[model samples]
Target: MKKYLIVGCGFSGAVVAEQLTKNENCKILVIDERSHIGGNCYSERDPNTNVMVHKYGPHIFNTSNKKVWDYINQFCEMMPFVNRVKTVYDGQIFSMPINLHTINQFFNKNFNPKEAEEFIEKQADKSISEPKNFEEQALKFIGKDLYQAFFYGYTKKQWGCEPKDLPASILKRLPVRFNYEDNYYSNIYQGIPRNGYTEIFRKMLSHPNIEIKLQTKFNESFNIDNFEHIYYTGPIDAFFNYKYGRLGYRTVYFERGEEIGDFQGNAVINYAEENVPYTRVHEHKHFTPWENHEKTIYFKEFSKETGNNDEPYYPKRLEEDLYKLELYLKEVEELKRYTFLGRLATYRYLNMDQVIEEALKIINE
Candidate 1:
C-alpha cells in the first residue's frame, strides 16, 4: 500500500486524488487552507436569494477537448452555457471580441463579412511586420479605434499595467470575428455544472481511500517523510519559503451587492473605460440559467497587484517573474518525493480544463 499527501484541494488535487484511489492499495489525504473543496472554482447558494453564487468569481466550464469534458461530466451534470460578454465604453454597450455586428454598430456602417475583414486589414498597422508587445499586436490586428474602445482600457485595468508593457501573447488569446457570432469562446463544448462546482469536487473525493482536511495549511511543521509522495498545488515560491522572493501576481477584489431582478440582463459586462474604477461586473444569477431567483447578486471586479496577505489569482509572468520562476524550478528539480500541480504550483495561468488534463497526465505518468 502507498500513501500520498495532496496539498490544496482544488481541481488539480481532487482529480489526482480521484484517479489514484482507483488503485485499492493507494491511500490519499487532501488538505486545503480554505474551508472549501473547489479552490477558486467554489460556488454555493446565496443565503438571501438562494441563487448559486460563484464565491471567488464566475467559472464557466468551456473546453474543446472531449476527453476533458467527458472526464468532468462523469462527476456532475453540465448545463449548456454560452458566454456572450458585453463591453461598455463612452456610455454605450457593444458586443465583445470585436465581431462584425460590433464593428457596424460602433462605426455606424453596414458592412458584410468580406467588407468588414477588408476594412480591418486596412485599419491594421501594415508597417509593423511583427508585433513585439500587446499594443503592437492590437494595432497590427484591428488598428487603433477598435483597440482603444475594447482592448486598451479593459486590458490596462485587468492587468494593472499599460498594454504596451504587457506581452503580445496576451492579446493573441482574443479573437477578431468577421461575423455576428458573439459567443465568447470558440470551444466546441461549453457549460456550467448543474449542482455547482463545489458539488463536482465533493463527488470527486468521495472514494473510500481518500481523506479531506479543510482549513489545514501546508507549512514547515508537516513532516515530509510521513507520506510516500507529496502533490503540492499551492504557490511554488511559498513552498520554498520565498527563498528567491515572491513571484508577481494580480489579485482581484469583488464588491458584491444584491438587487431586485436582473442587474444587467447579462452574465458579465466589461467596463472598458479607464475612468471607471472596476474592470467588470458579474451577474451571478444569470450564470445558472437553469434556476430563477427574485433577487440577483452581482460583483464589481477590481484588479490590483497581489500582496503578501492577498490571494494570488492571475500570474503576472513578466520577464522578471519568469527569471524568478526559473530559479524556483531549479530548486524543484533538486527535491525528492514531491510533484507540483496546477496553476499556482507551476506559476502559470491555466484554465480549469487544462488543470484537469495536466492532473490526469501526471497521474498516468
Candidate 2:
C-alpha cells in the first residue's frame, strides 16, 4: 500500500485524510504543530464555565452545501444554530447586516418591507454606473450614510486599509435582508457539531491506517520524500520557506472576561466604530443556544499584523500579497511531491463547508 503525508490537522487535512484512507489503499501520517486537532476551530469544555468554548475565536458553521453538511454530520451530530449578530455604534445596539428593521429604526421611519426596499434604493448612489472599490461598492448599493453608519469605520479598522483600496469583490454578496431577518447566514444547512470539534477530529482519524503526530514539526529528517504525496494545509508562503517574499496575514488577539449573566444579547456583536479598538465581541454561551449557561464567556477580538509567534487567522490578500503569491505559486510548481489544500495553503478565506467540499473534490481527483 502507498503512504501519504498530511501536514496540519485542520478540517482540510482531517477530511482529506479520512476520505483518502477510505477511497485508496494509502497509509496516512497526519501532523500538526498544535497539541490538539481541529486547527483554529478547536473547541473544548471551558474550565471556567463548563461550556465548550471556541478556543481561538468563535467559528459558526454556516454553509449551503448539503453534501458538505451531510459528510460532517456522519462524524458528529449537528445542533441547529442561527448566527444572530448584533452591532454597537455610538453606544446604540442594532442588528448587524443592516436588515429592514435596522433601516427603519435607524432612520426613525415606520417602513414595511416594500417601503424599506425603496428607501434603500433611494439612499443608494444611483449615479454610480460602476463601483471603483469596496467603499464605492457599498455606497452604490446601500448608499453613503448607511455605509458610514455600518461599514466605513468598521471595515477600515478590521482591514487597516481604506475600503477604497480594497477590491469591490470583497463586499460582494454580504448578507442583507429586505425583511427583519438578522441571521448572519441564510444557509439551509447550519449548526454546531453536538460534541466539540475535537470529537469530529477523532472520528475523521479513527481508521487503522492513519497515524497522527501532534506537536510535531516537519523538517528534512521527517522523510516526507518517502511518501507518495504531501498534503500541506499550512501557510503557502511558509511552506516554500518564504522563497517568494511573504504573504501577509492578520493575526487576532482576544480579551476574555467572565459574565455571571448574559454579557451581550447575541453570540456575535460587531463594534463598528473606528474608535473601538476591537472589532467584535463573541458571547460563547449563545453558541450552544439549545442549552443555557449561568455564566458567559466572551471575547473582545482585536486584529494585528501576523508575526512568527502569532498564529495566522485572516489572510490579508491585498495587491502586494498577490504579487508574493505569484512567486509562491511558481515555487509550489517546483516542489517534488506535495499537494496544497485549504484556505491557508491557497491563501484564501474559506468557510468550513468550503474546506470539506474542496477536500472531497481533491479525493475524487
Candidate 3:
C-alpha cells in the first residue's frame, strides 16, 4: 500500500488528501499544530447563544470560478450571502468600497454617477502620472480626502506600516465604484456554508483512507522517510528554521464579547480611524441571518507584528521579506520528497477559492 503524509489540515491539505484518496491502495496521514481541522476558516456554534461563531474571523466563501464554486458545494449547502460591508469614519456610517453612495455621503453632494466620476477625477492628484506606492495609488484613484478617510488609517493599522512604505501593486486594482453597488466582493458566487466551515473540512477529511492527528507539530526532526511523499502547508520560514530570517507577517488577535439581541446589527463594520485601535468589529450572528438567535457574539480585531508564539495571519511581503522568500524557494527546489502548498507555505495572501484551485492543480500535476 502507498502511504502519504500531509502537514496542516486546512483547505489546501484537506483538498489534496481527499483527491489523493481516490487512488487505489493508498493511505494518508493528516496533522495540524492547532487542535482543529479548519485553519483560520474554522467556525463553531456558541453554546450560550447557539450562534455559529467564526473562531479565527469571519470567512465568506466567494469565487468567480464556477468550477471552484461547484467543487466546494459538494461538501455542504452554501447559504446565499452577499457581503455589504459598512465603515465608520468621523462618527458616520457609510457603505464600503467607496461606492457612489459613499462618495455622495462623504462629499455631502447629490451628484449623479457621471457627475461623481467627474468630481473624483478633479479630486484625484493630477500631478501624479504614475503612482510609486500605496499612498500615491490611493491618491491617484480616489484623492486625498477619500484616501485619508478610508484607506490611510485602516491600511496603517492592518499592515503595521504607513501606506507610503507599501508597494503600489497592493492597490493596483481600482477600489471604487461609480454606481451605488456596495457588494463588498464582486464574485459570481458568494455564501457561508449552512453547516459551518468546520463541517466542510470534516467532510473532506473523513475519507476511509485518511487518518488525522491534532496538536501534532511538524519540524525538521519529524520522521518523513516512511511516507511516499509529504505535503507541507505550514509557514515556509519555519520549515527552514528561520535560517534566512523570518519572513515578515502581521497577525491579528481578537477581543471577544457577547451581547443580547444584537451588537453591531451587521456582520462586519470597519473602524477606519487610526484612533479607534481595532480595525473591525464583527458580529458572528449577523453572518448567518437565516438563523435566529437572541444573543450575538462580536469580536474587536486588532492587527500587530507576528511574534514567535502567534499564528501568522497576513504576509507583509516587504522588500526584505521577498529576498528571504527567494532564498527559501531555492532550498525548497533541492528537496525532492517534500511539496509546500497553501497561503503560509507559499507566503502569499490567497482567497479560499484560489487556495482550492492551487491544491487541485498540484494533485492533477
Candidate 4:
C-alpha cells in the first residue's frame, strides 16, 4: 500500500486524510504539535455551565458553496444560526455591517433605504476616485464620520495598526447593506455544529487507514523517505526554519468570566471605542441557542502582535510580509514531494469555508 505523512490535524489535514482514505489504497499518518484534533476550531463543553465554548474565540461556519455545506453535514448536524453582531459606540448599541438601521441610528435620523443611500453617498469622499489603503477605502465607501465611529478604533485594535497601513483588499470582504438585514454573513449556508466542532473532527478522522499522533511536532530533521508524499499544513516560515524571515501575524488572547443569568444577551458585541482594552466580548451560551444553561460563560477577546508562545491567529500580510511570502513560494515551486495547503501554510487570511474548499480541491488535484 502507498504511504503518506500529513502534518497538522486541522480542517486541511483532516479533509485530505478523510478523502484520500476513500480514493486510494493507502495508509496515512497524521501528526499535530497540539494534543487536539480540531486545531483552533477545537470546542468542548464547559464543566461549569455545560456550554460549548470556542477555545479560540467565535467561529461561525458560513459558506455559499453547496458542495461544502453537503460535505460538512455528512459528519454532524449543523444547527441553523444567524450571526447578528452588534457594536457599542459612545455608549450606544448599533447593528453591525452598517445596515440601514445602523445608519439611521448613528445619524439620529429616520431615513428610508433610498434616502439613506443618498445621504451616505454625499458623506463619502468624492475627491478620491480610487482607494489605495483600508482607511481610504472606508472613506470612499462610507465617509469619514461613519468610518471613524464604526471601523477606526475597532480595526486599529483588531489589526494592531492604522487602517491606512493595511491593504484595501482587506476591507473588501465586509458588506454594506441598504436594507435592515442584520445577518453578519451574506452566505447562503450558515450554522454551528449540533455537536461541538471537535466531534466533527473525531468523525472525519475515524477511518481505519488513518493513524493520528497528537503532540508530535514536525521539523526539518523528520524522515520523509518512507512516505510517497508529505502534506504540511503548518506555518510556511517554520518549515524552512525561517530561512528568509519570520512572517508577520497577529494573535489573540481571551479573559474569561462567568455570570449568574445572561451576560451580553448576544453572541458577540464589538467595543468600537479605542479606550476599551478588549476588541469584542463573546457569550458562549448564545452560540448554541438551542441548548439551555442557567449560568453563562463569556470571554473578552484582546488582539496583539504574535508572541513566541502565542498561536498565530490572523496573518498580517503587509507589503513586507507579502515580499517574504513570494520568496517562500519560489522555494515551494522547487519541491516535488511536498504539498502545502490551508491558511497558515499559504499565509492568507481565509474564512473556514474557504479553507475547506481549498482542502477538497487540493486532494482532487
Please, what are the lDDT tens digits per residue for candidate 1 over residues 12-98?
Answer: 999999999985578899999998898999999989999998999989999989999999999999999999999999989999878
1-365 in candidate 4: lDDT tens per residue? Answer: 99999999989999999999989999999999998899899999999989999999999999999999999999999999999999999999999989999999999999999999999999999987888999999999989999999999999999988999999988875578999999999989999999889998999999999999999989877888899998899999999889999999999999999998899899999999889999999999999999899999999999999987789989988999999999999999999999999889999978888989999999988
lDDT of 2 by residue, 1-365 (tens): 89899999999999999999888888999999889998998999888887788899988787888888889899998998888788888778888778987888789899888988898889899888888789889989889888998898888887878899988878876566889888788889888987778899999999999999999987656776678889999888877678777788888899988879898778899989899999999888888877778888889999788888899888877889999998888888888788898989999999889998999998898
lDDT of each: 0.92, 0.87, 0.93, 0.93
TM per candidate comes to: 0.98, 0.96, 0.99, 0.99
> What TM-score does candidate 3 get on C-alpha atoms?
0.99
Candidate 2: list runs displaced more than 4 Å: none
Q: Which stretches of candidate 1 lie over 4 Å from their true place?
A: none
Question: In order, how many clashes per candidate?
Answer: 0, 0, 0, 0
User: How well is each residue in 1-365 modelled by candidate 3, as lDDT tens digits?
Assistant: 88999999899999999999965579999999999999998989899999998899889999999989999999999999989899999999999989999999999999999999999999999898899999999898889999999999999999989999998978868778899999999999999999899999999998888999999989977888889999999999999999999999999999989988998888999999999999999998888989999888899999999999999998988899999999999999999998999999999999999999999999999
Candidate 4 or 1, higher lDDT: 4
Candidate 3 shows a clash count of 0
